[model samples]
Target: MKESEKHISHFDIVVIGGGASGMMAAGTAAARGKRVCIVEKNNELGKKLKITGGGRCNITNATYDIHALLSMYGKAHKFLYTPFSLFGVNDTFRFFEERGLPLVVEAGNRAFPHTHNAHDVFRVLEKYCIDNGVVVMLDAPVERMVMCRTKARIDAIETSKGSITARAYIFATGGASHPETGSTGDAFHWLKDMGHTVTPPSPNIVPLRTAESWVHTLSGVSVDSMKITFLVDGVKKFHKTGKILFTHFGLSGPLILNSAHTIADMLHEGVVTASVDVVPHLAHGDLDKHIQEIFSEHKNKNFKNVAEYIAPHGMAVSLMMMPGMPLSDTKVHSITKEERKHIVHTLKDMRCTITGLMGMDKAVVSDGGVPLGDIDLKTMRSRLVDNLYITGDLLHINRPSGGYSLQLCWTTGWIAGSCAE
Candidate 1:
């Protein structure tokens, strides 16, 4: 049989990329009695969704105030007003709860499956698609879109397997980050060819790589709470405070991942540095007094041994090893006034030179995709292309982690699915 003729099917709606948004869109459309087909390049569905929140898919934020939720999106918050109003976070909670999937809230109002299994979330979404009669075509990567000369609508989709003609098409190919999850920014180029404006993708929630090799020695080390200040050309640019992790490559965890976008941009222009405050809650005077107390209590102990109480064990050792700082073997009581001041400073602000980002593969999510101007906010239908809807990371919206990104998927996917003609 010819490759072109071996796999061809028709549907009322065809959704590309079977991640969070595509699956939701396909399921919703199919539930409305539309013959929906999902085209996914991966062998399985929701490859990315299966790995979110370290494999415990954060479904949505527990923040119920619409205003507060919107503010979390920053500038893109305005564009989400209509979509989220239709299917806000509360609606998201209900959608899953009604489907027999209970969610639990964490420290930051992040809602995850009660079972804490991302695979469970994917299972539910896949089951939703099946229950609604949506046909999924896996390993069917799209090649191009067939467009009409006189109309702003897709006629057919040219794919790696064959061509699929649909009355309505939804592109949810996602952003360029985590290419291993099959999000290679394919739709950005395809949409550009279809005359839609696309924002070039950049690593948004990526980790930072430090120039210091000592950072690698601190691998697997984590601070429950700390503050990091981004400095360009030796001047402060911005700061973030939260859980921080030291990796073999550099700094990561919640704080560094969220700050990578700005840091990446700054690194492109000039030398970027970071000052990590291990104890931001303590004032200089208070920290000095605290250190004095610790020294007095451990006067006979090595300085390194006493420093452990002030910072992570790895951090304490690193501080003592810093140039001109006190020796690790020095007794806590023997440390001079100058050394005491240095110890205080190190506890407050340990510095590092940030060389670059940890690469897109290590990024939690990427920012920028198809700009919002190309799609109608109310319906999610493309203004430039009729019979076409865009949803999820495929659209250029910079969102932070902690359920904001997945919420975008649920809101836009529902809108695109419900409003598609």
Candidate 2:
């Protein structure tokens, strides 16, 4: 028998795209004694999962209150009540813990494996599918979805390997974020062809590319705590306080990534700029006194030499390079009170202009897929196609980082797997 006939021709359920939701759906269906198969394009499953949260795998947001948890999903929060009801945050905790993968909640109520390794998260999901006897088909990319001749039902999927037929189908192929991980939004096109409205995808949870060359110099520096204020054409719009990592390309870390979409909207208004307050906790008077003391202590030294004593580590040089700021080479003893005040202001309001959001290639999550109205949220089934279910990023839901995306996957996948016939 060829690769096409390697497994049984028919399965109780066929799940496409073996990432977080696909694996969860397949395992859940198999646990119900249904024959399930997950067709993955990549040779290994969980390609995206292994790299989430910078390889730590933020498993889920541990916000157990259903209403509060759903609110993180933005406008789609209302549509998620049914699916989340089936498998809420507490159920996620119980499911993984029952499977021997104890999760620990960190700051921001984000949950992770005890080992803090994404591979460990993948291991648990992979084992869940294996223990439930779900068939795993690797390197089998589905080319298209075939429909039954007389009805609006998915009959079978034509894959690179062969044809796969199932009574019920689940499309968890994900959105166009991190294409290298194999989630290239292939299912969106198929869903559109099948008569489902697919919202065009855009990178929502991604980093901001900046117009400043100085930001590039401070590449790997991460400020543990700082206040960043967003300004549109010099008018202050909003501000956030958190950790931020400066990248060669731009700004990242949880704070910047979560703020990218909002900044993207601000870009449409006018010139977007951000002011980074290096010492947010300290008042200007206190900071000036502290800096004056530092200057007094190093009176004989050049300002550049003692710059690190003032600003956050690795940020002093870049902060000094800000336009209209004092010269770094000036002797501390000779520096005027006004120049010192300028240094304090520059440190407190370090500026960088926002260019735009990073492309889908660097996106943590992309929004845009089948709208919630097209699906029966309670069953995770397509209202248009009776036997087809949707899960994960394939649904257009805008959510910030900090494990909310993975939580959506787990909730929808479990519900679809359990309810699909």
RMSD in angstroms, all models? 1.7, 1.9
- Tens digits of per-residue lDDT for model 1, 1-421: 6756755988899999999999999999999999999999999899999999999888899999988888888778888788888999989989998988999999899999999999989988999999999999999999888898788778999888889999999999998888999999998888888887777887788888898876777889998888888889998998888999999989989888778777777978789988888888998889989888888989999877786886665676667666677778888888998888887887787888998887778877777777787789888999988899999988877767899999999999999999887
Displacement of the residue 238 alpha carbon in candidate 2, Å: 1.1
lDDT per residue for candidate 2 within 1-421, as digits (tens), equals 6755743478999999899999999999999999999999999999999998889999999998899988898889989888888899998899888988899999999999998999988988999999999999999999977799999999888888778899999999999999999999999888988899988899988989998988889999999999999999999999999999999998988899989878888999999999999899888999999999998999989878888999898987897787766577788999889888888888888889998999999999887888999999988999999899999999999899989999989999998999999
- Model 1: per-residue Cα lDDT at residue 376: 93
In model 2, which regions exceed 4 Å deviation? 1-8
**Model 2 compared with the native: what TM-score?**
0.96
N/CA/C clash count, model 1: 1
TM-score of each: 0.95, 0.96
lDDT (C-alpha, whole model) for all candidates: 0.87, 0.91
